[model samples]
Structure formats: C-alpha cells, structure tokens
Target: MVYLAEFVGTAILTLLGCGVVAGVALARSKALAGGWIVVTFGWGMAVTMAVYVAGTTSGAHINPAVTLGLASIGEFDWALVPGYIGAQLVGAFFGACLVYLAYLSHWKITEDPDAKLSVFSTIPAVRNPVANLTTEIIGTAMLLLGILGIGANSGAVSAGQADLANLFTNGLAPLLIGLLVFAIGLSLGGPTGYAINPARDLGPRVAHALLPIAGKGPSDWGYSWIPIVGPVIGGVLGAWIWNLTGFGS
Candidate 1:
C-alpha cells in the first residue's frame, strides 16, 4: 500500500509537472510561452498536491532522491528503498503518458523537436558534462537538505515513527516543500534544469522515447545518466551532512 501511494503520488507529480511544460511549450495552448516563472510555480504546486495525496500512506517520498536520502539518515528503511524508487519511476512514466494524451493534437503543430523533448525531460542550456553534473548534484543536495530540515522541524517522521498526518496536515510540510522546490527552480534550475529527482527525469524521458509523439526527437539518452547519478550522490551527501551536524538527532 505504501508502494502504491508512492507510485500514485509520483504519477501525479509527473502528470502536472510535465503537463505545465506541455501547456507552456506546445502550440495553441493558452499558456504557451508562459516563461520560467510559470513552469517553476507549476512544478512547485505539483509537488504540493502529490504530497497532500500520498504523504499519509508513503511519507510522500515521490522522488527517488528523497527516499534514498531519508534511508541514509535512518529516517526510512533501506530495505524498502528499491520498491519506493521503482514505484516512483513507474508512476512518472504513466504521468508523462497522460501528458502526451492530454496534448494529443499539439505535437503535430509544434515544430521544434527539442521543445517536445523538453516537456518530458530536462535539457541543459550549456551541455558540458562536468558542469551539468555538478549543477545537478548541488541542486539535489539543497533539496535533500531542505527536506531534512522540514522533517526535523515538523517531527513528522521521527526515528521510528512515520506519521503521515503530522507530516502533511499538522506540520504543513507539503506547502513548505512546494515552496522549496519553487525556490530551487527559480534560483538553481538554469544549469541543468534542476532535475533533483532521478525518477522525475528518467521515467518521463523513457516515456518520451516510447510514446508516439509527432516529430519527436531523440530521447537524449546520452545525457540521461547525469540526472540519475548526480541526484543520488547529492542525496546521500546531504543526508550524511545532516547526520554529521546532528540536526535531526
């Protein structure tokens, strides 16, 4: 059931998050070219909604990095990490598919293949591997750190207790998390588009490769590993730092 919640929550996150990109980038949409601020706010709200819906069941670790980071900090069981990540990936795939369906006709109208691809995954403004990887790592580290701070403040998930109600309802962690993501997107997203969550990037990128969208370009498989590897590294580092600091003790 917890796995199911993670899946559903991640799916919702991808659906709304990618959906905004589609609306802003796709042709004939009212939100076309709405700009970065709109995309950032949309993703932030997406995270909030997903957390509200799934926090009670799965602690709302919709992002793989979040799951891994918590495990590293002893907030979550390491044994369950695989299931959580798998569910998150599957959910993100379905969510991206839904976005494709929602914008069924727009693909043909949109001339830029890169734009279509952008809806599914992050694209760096400058494609330097080292720099891109560094940006992702830093952004994701910030994400995990912020999440740990939020959890500590809320007492939502103590050493052994994972109380969903306290996390979302009592502590308002969902709203704060949304704002955190919003801030990240606004401040640090320019480099690698701030793909702090591996599942958030890879699942949708896979969907983009499999789905039949008109004039769709390459899935950019060559650059896919950075978002996954960098975030995992960042998450672990963030959790390790938190533990060292005794912040969540």
Candidate 2:
C-alpha cells in the first residue's frame, strides 16, 4: 500500500505539473495567458496536493530524490527505497501520458519540437553541460534541505517541542513545502528548470521519447543524465548537511 500510495501521489503530481506546461506552452491552449509564474506555482501546488493525498499512507515521497535522501540519512528504511522510487517513476510516466492525451489536439499545431518536449521534461536555458549539472545539483540540494527542515522535530514523527514539530501532522507542512518548491523555481529554475526529482524528469523524458506526438522532436537524450545524477548526489549531499546541523536533536 505504501508503494501504491507513492505511485498515485507522484502520478497526480506529474499530471498537474505537466498539464500546466501543456496549457502554457501548447498552441492555442487557454493557459497561453500564463507565463513562468504560472508554471512555478503549478508545480508547487502539484507537490502540495500530492502530499495531502498520500501523506498518511506513505509520507508522500512523490519524488524519488526525497525517498533517496531520507534513506541516505537513515531516516527511512533502505529496504523500501527501490519500491518507492520505482513507483514514483512509473507514476510520473503515466502522468506525462495523461498530459499527452489531454493536449492531443495541440501537438501537431505546435511546430516547435522543443516546446513539445518541454511539456514533459526539463530543458536547460543554456546549453552548457557543466553549468546545467551544477544548477540541478544546487537546486535539488536546496530541495532536500527545505523538505527536511519543514518536518524537522514535527510532533507527528518524534518527541519534541509541541509547537513546531506538528508541521508534518498539522497539515501546514504541505503548503510550506509547496512554497519551498515555488521559491526554488523562481530563484533556481532558470538554468535547468530544476529537475530536483529524478522520477519527475526521467520518467517524463522517457515518455517524451516513447510517445507518438505529431511533429515532435528528439528527447535531447544527451542532456538527460544530469537531472538523474545531479539530483541523486544533491539529495545525499543535502541529507548529510542536514544531519550535521543536528536541528532535530
């Protein structure tokens, strides 16, 4: 059930996240009225709602990065890592598929292959691999730190100060985490679109490659490694840093 929860949660997350991109970037879509602000908030709210849906059953680690980060820090059982990540990946793939079906009519009309691809995965604003990787690493590290900080000492999880520790259980944690994502998007999304979660990027990117969208371009496989590798490293790095801080202690 935990794995299933993660699957459902991540699917919802990616569905909304990609849906917003489709709305804004697709030809003649109503969301064309939107811009970067809409995209950022859309992702943030996606995270929030997904968390609410799966928080009780699975802690809602909708992103593989979150699951790995917690496991690396010994906060989660390593035995469960594979299942959680697998579920997230499959969920993300399905979510992107849903976005495709929703925008079935717009793909052929939208001539830019890049724009079509962007609906599914991240693309670096600049084409420098080193710089792009660095951006993803930094963004994901911040994400892990922010997520940990939000639930630190939460009364729902541990014995601690009653006032603040309840964030996880009290329901405000999701909104704060959502804000964290929004902040990251506004501040760090320029370089690589902040593929802070491996499942979020890789699964959808794979979908982009496999799906039969009209006039679609290549999936840019050349740049795909950074999002996966960077976030994994960043998740571990952030977990180690947070543990060193001893905030929960």
Candidate 3:
C-alpha cells in the first residue's frame, strides 16, 4: 500500500509539474511563455495536491531523495528504500508520458527542441559540469533539510498536546513542503533548474527519449548523471546533518 501511494503521489507530482512546463513552453497553449514564476508555483501546487492525496498512506515521500534522506536519518526503514525509489521512478515515467499526451499536437508547433526537452527534464543555463552538479547538490540539500525540520517539528509535539500536534498534523506539513519547494524554485532554481529529486529528472528524461515527440532533440544523456548523483549525495548529507542535530528525538 505504501509503495502504491508513493507511485501514485509521484505520478501526480510529475503530471502537474511537467504539465505546467508544457503549457507555458508549448506553442498554441494559452499560457505560452507564462514564465518561470508560473512554473515554480505550478510545481509547488503539484506537490501540495499530491501530498494531500497520498501523505496518510506513504508520508508522501514521492521523491527518491526524500526516501533515502529519511532512511539515512533513521526515520524510514532502509529495507523499504528500494521499493519506494522504484515506485517513484515508474510513476514519474508515466506522468511524463501523460504530459506528452496532454500536449500531443503542440510538439510539432513548438520549434525549439530544447523547449520540448525542458518540459520533461532540466537543462542548465551554463553547461559547466562541476558547477551544475554543485547547484543540484545545494538545492537538494536545502530541500532535505527543510523536510527534516518539518518532520522534527511534527514529532516533537507531545501525545497529550493536542493543539500543538494539530499544528503539524491535518495536512500542514504537506502545505509547508509545497511552499518550501516554491521558495527553492524561486531563489535557487536558475542553476541546473533545481532538480532536487533524482527520480523527478531521470524518469521523465527516459520518457522523453522513448516518446515520439516531433522535433524532440537529444535527451541530453551526458548531463543526466549530475541530477541523479548530486541529489542522492545531497539527500544523504542533509539527513546526516539533521540527524546530528537530534531534533526529531
């Protein structure tokens, strides 16, 4: 059940998140060129909605980085990590495919191949491998840190403290997480497009390569490893740092 929740949550996340990118970047859409702010808000809302739908069952760890981070911090079982990540990857792939279906006709009209690819995966503004990797690491580290903080706060509430527990419960954590994502996108997203989750990038990139979209350019496989590796490393580091703080206990 948990694995299924993760899969569905991640699929929804990718669907709406990438859907916004397609809406803005694809030709013949009313929101064409809706700009970065729109993309950021759309992704944030996607996270919020997905979490609302799946948080109770799976804690809404829709991203592999989040699953790994929680495990590293001893908040999640290491045994379940692989299944969670696998589900997230599968979900993201289907979600990207849905985006392709949603904008089936727009691909041919969109002249820029990079734009089409951008709807599925991120592309760096300046392609410096080291710098791009660093940016992704930093963004993901911040994400994990914020998530741990939210979880810690929720766990800190005493059993008898109903009011305090309610502050963290009943969907507050998910909402804050969405806002945190929005903030990250606004401030830290320019470099490497803030791919803080590995599954979020790789799964969709794979879909981009497989799907027959008109004028779709190369999947940019060379740059793919950075998003995957950097976020995993960052998630581990962030969780380790949070564990050291001992906030949740």
Candidate 4:
C-alpha cells in the first residue's frame, strides 16, 4: 500500500511539475512566458496533494533524505527506512516516466534546448556546484525542520459524539507543512529554487536523460550530486537541530 501510494503521489507530482513547465516553456501555450512563480506554486500544490494522499500510512517523506534524517534523530522507525527510500525512488522514477509520456508531443514542438530541459527536470541558474549545493541544503533543512515541529506538536481530539453531531478531527501538521514549503520558496529557494527533495530532483533528472526529447541539453550530471548530497546532509542537520531542542524526543 505504501509503495502504491508513493507511486501515485510521485506520478502526480511530476505530472504537475513537468506539465507546468511544458505549459510555460513550450511554444503556443497560454502559460508560455510565465516565470518562476508558476513553478514554485505548482510544486507547492503538488506536495500538498501528495501529502494529503500519503500522509497517513507512509508519512509521505517521498524524499530519502527525510526518511534517513528522521531515523537518525530517533523520530522514525529505523527498520522501515530502506523500504521507504526505495519506494520513494521507484515512485519518482515512474512519475518521471509518466511526465515524459505526457509531454512527448510538446517536446517535438519546443525548439529551445534549455526550455526543453526545463519541461522535465531542474537546472541551476549558475553552474557553481558549491553554491548550488548549499542552496539545496539550506532549502531542504528549512523544510525538514518545519516538518519535525509539525509532527511533534500537532494532534487531534474529538470534541463531540452523536449520530449527526459527531466531530471530525484534523491536525495542524499539514497546514504548517504547507506554510513551511511556501516560506522556503519565498526565501531560501532563490539560488537553485529549492530542489530539496532528492527523489524529486534525481528521478526526473534520470528521466530527462533517458527520454528522447529533441533539442534537450546535457542532464547537468556534473552537479547532480548536489541535490542528493545536499538534501541528505541538510535533512540530518535539521533533524539534529530539532533533537537538540528536544522536539524529536
């Protein structure tokens, strides 16, 4: 069930992520010439929906770094980490594949190399590995920290019980999580615009390389390690900070 949830969640994420890119970057579209704002909010909504779907069973880490970090900080069950990461990556890979299929026709129409690349994956504004890596790290750290707080602090209680008067319960965790992502986009995301999820970055990146899109540029392999490494380090750091503050205990 977890695997299936991740699979569907990630497919939706890439569909939206890449779909919006196709809309904005491809020729003859209403969203063409749109800017970063579209991408940022699009991703935010993607995360929200993904979480809404997968939050209960798998916790919807969806990023390996997040699972590893939470485990390291003793907030998650270590026994489940590997399976979770594997599910996330598989889900992401399938998602990217779907994006490729969905946008294949658009690829033929788009002539711009960079824009074509944008339709499927991320690229740094500047090619400095260190700076881009740091950006990803900071962005991921912010995200994880807020998630930890939300998880630790949130709860629900039924205030009434009746046939028609029964209360529905909800937690603030999702809202806080969404706001944290929003803040990350607004603040620390400017550098690389926050490819904070390792699977989110790497899976579609692999699809971009594998897919036969015309005029596609290099997959940016030289800097690929940044997204993977940065998020892991940053997630651990965020979890560490949360633990230090006694939030993870």
Candidate 5:
C-alpha cells in the first residue's frame, strides 16, 4: 500500500507539475512562455494531492527534505527514512519520465532553452547566488515549519495521551499547515519557484539530464546543488525554530 501510494502520489505530482510546464511553454504558441504563478500553484496543488492520498500511511513525505526533517524530530523512524527517500526518488523519476513522454510532440516545436530545461527541472528566474540561496532557505524553512506544526511531537498533551477530540475536531492544524506552504510560495517563490523538496527538485533534474531530445539546452549543473543544500539547511532551521518555540506544544 505504501509503495502504491507513493507511486500514485509521485505520478500525480509530476503530472500536474509537468502539465503546467507544457501548458505555459508549448501552448503559448511559438516563443511565448508562462509565468511564475503557474509554476507556484502547480507545485502547491501537487503537494496537496500527494499528501491527501498518502498522508495516512507514509505521512506523504515524498521529499527527502521532509523525511530527513521528520526523522530529526523523532516524529519519523530513522529506519524508514532511507526507504522513504528512495521510494520518493523512484516515484519522482518515473513521474517525470511520463511527463516527458506526454510532452514529446510539443517539445519538438519549441526552441527556447529555458522552456525546454523547465519541462523537467527548475532554473533561476533572477540568477543571483546569494538571493537564490536565501530564497530556497526561506522557502524550505516555511515548508518545514508547516510540517512541524502539523506533525509535531504530541508528548506535551499528557504523559501518554493526547487530546484527540480537540485536535481532530478543530481543523486549525491542517489549515495552518497548508497555509504555511501557500504563504511561502506567495512570498518567496518569485526568484526560483521554491524547490523546497530535494527529491522533487533533484529527481526531475536527473530526468532532464538523461532524457534524449533534439536541440535541448545545456543542463545547469553548476547551480543544481543549491536546491539540495539550501533545502536541507532551511529544513533544519525550520525544525529547530519549531522545536525551540514549542508551537505545537
């Protein structure tokens, strides 16, 4: 069931993700392109569906950053992180592959290197190292903060019991979590579209690198590391902040 959920979730994420690209890039006639809003909402909706489908069993952690952060807080088992990350990556890879297949016909019509690169992975909107790094850090931090809020340690409720009634009946927690992500995207996603999930960013990035296509542009290997490192650092910071404040306490 976990594997199935991961597959479906990952596929859904990629479908919406790459679909947005196709819509904005190819559907724009010849040289036109879609803007940031399409990408931001594309990912936001991807996450929403991914979590709604797999949240109960696998915690819907379809990102390495999420798995790592959850394990650090002891909310997730360390033994499971490797498997979760691995599964997430595999799922993302296949999902991106499917997207590529779906868009192959349209891909033949476009000549923009940026548009081609975007169909599989991310690229900086305003290429500045410090700014991009900071954007990723803040974006991932917001995501982690939302997760910590949603899945924080329940020990503070009682020695061995939690107030299930209030926690479940009141939808405050889940709403806050979703809004956190929306807020981050709305505020900080302008620069790089906020690749807060390492797997989400890297797996598709790999697909972009490996896939064969005519007139494809160069893979931006030099800046690829920023998404991975920035998210990890921001996730840690977000988790630390949540732990320190005891917001979910």
Candidate 6:
C-alpha cells in the first residue's frame, strides 16, 4: 500500500509538472509562452499537491533520487529501495502519459519536436554535457539537502518549539518543500531545466518514445544518463553530508 502511494504520488508529480510545460510550450495553448515563472510555480505546486496526496502513506518520496538518498543515509530501508524506485518510475511514466492525453491535439499542431519533447523531459538550454550534468548535480544536491533539513526541523514541534515548528509540521512541510523546488528552478534551472530527479526525467522520456504522439521525435537517450546519474550522485552526497552533521538527531 505504501508502494502504491509512491506510485500515485509520482504520477501526480509528473502529470502536473509536465502539464505545465505543455501549457507553456505547445503552440496555441492559452498559456503558450507563459515563461519560466509560471513553469516553476506550476511544478512547485504540483509537488506540494502530490505530497499532500501521498505523504501519509509513503512519506511522499516521489523522486528516485530522494528515495535513494534516504536509504543511503540509513534513514530508509534498503530492502524497500528497489520497490520504491520501481513505483516512482512507473508512476512517472503514467503521469507523462496522462499529460500526453490531456494535450492530445497539441502535438501535431505544435510543429516543433523540441517543444513537444520538453513537455516530457528536460532539455539543456546550451546542450553541453559536462555543464548540464554539473547543473543537475548541484540542483539535486540542493534538493536533498533542503529536504533533509526540513525533515530535521519537523521534530521541532516536540522540542519545545511548537509554535516555531508549526510551519514544518502537520501539513505545512509539503509547501515548504515545494518552495524549495521552486527556488531551485528559479536559481539553477536555466542550464538544463533542472532534471533533479531520475524518475521524473527517465519515465517521461520513455513515455515520449513509446506513446503515439505526432512527431514526438527521439527520446535523446544519449543525455538521459546525466539526469539519472547526476541526481543519484548528488542525492547520496547530500544525504552523507546531512548525516555527518547529525542535524536531524
């Protein structure tokens, strides 16, 4: 059931995250060219909503990077890592499929394969592998760092700081985490659109290849490893640093 929660949560995450890209990038869409601010906010809100949906059941580790990070730090069970990641990937795939279905007519009319692709996956603005990988690494590192930090503080409600901890407890933690992602997008997303989660990028890219979308183009497998590898590396790094600091203890 917890695994199912992971699946549903990830599905919601990609559905709204990709939906925003479709809304902003696809030709003739009302929000076409809505710009980065809208995209960032939409994705942030998507995370918040998904967390609200699944946080109780699965802790809302919708991203594989996050699941792996927590497990690597001994904060989550190694036995459950594979199950969590599988659920997240499958959920993300279905979410991207939902996005495709939602904008069924936009594909052919959009005319730009690149624009269509962006709806399913991240694309580097400059297309430099080294730089793009670095950016993703930094972005995901910040994500895990912020997440663990928030988790650390969620205990404040029991630490004689109930009023001060209200923002991190009950239901507010999700919103703060969402804002963290938004800040990441605004600050570090330009380089590679911030593919900070392996499942978020891979599942949707795979869906793009498999789905019968008009002129969806190549899934760009060559660059896929960066988002997957960089996030894993960065996530582990962040978790280790947090563990070493023992802030949550």
Clashing pairs for predicted structure model 6, backbone only: none
Off by over 4 Å in 4: 156-172
Q: Where does candidate 6 have its weakest 10-residue lDDT segment?
A: 158-167
Alpha carbon lDDT at 138, candidate 4: 82
Model 2 stretches with alpha carbons more than 4 Å out: 156-170
Q: Which portions of model 1 show Cα errors greater than 4 Å?
A: 156-171
TM-score for each model: 0.94, 0.94, 0.95, 0.88, 0.85, 0.96
Ranking by lDDT: 1, 6, 3, 2, 4, 5
lDDT comparing candidate 6 with the true structure: 0.92
Clashing pairs in 1: none
Q: Cα deviation of 19 in candidate 3 (Å)?
A: 0.6
Candidates by TM-score, descending order? 6, 3, 2, 1, 4, 5
Global Cα RMSD, each model: 3.7, 2.5, 1.8, 3.2, 4.2, 1.7
lDDT of 5 by residue, 36-127 (tens): 67666666676776777676666677777777876787767889777787788888878888888877777777777777778777688899
What does the lDDT read for residue 229 in candidate 3? 91
lDDT of 1 by residue, 173-248 (tens): 8999999999999999998888899999999999999998989999999999999999999988888888899977
- Which 10 consecutive positions of candidate 1 have the poorest summed lDDT? 162-171
Count of clashing residue pairs in every prediction:
0, 2, 0, 0, 0, 0
- Candidate 2 per-residue lDDT, tens place, 1-249, comes to 999999999999999998998999999999885999999999999999999999989999998788888998899999999999999999999999999999999999999999999999999988898898888888889998988888774554644544545545657888888899999999999888888999999999999999999999899999999999989888888888999998766
Query: What does the lDDT come to for candidate 5?
Result: 0.73
Tell me the lDDT of model 5 at 167: 54
How does model 4 score by TM-score? 0.88
List per-prediction Cα lDDT, in the order shown: 0.92, 0.90, 0.91, 0.75, 0.73, 0.92
* Candidate 4 lDDT score at position 219: 86
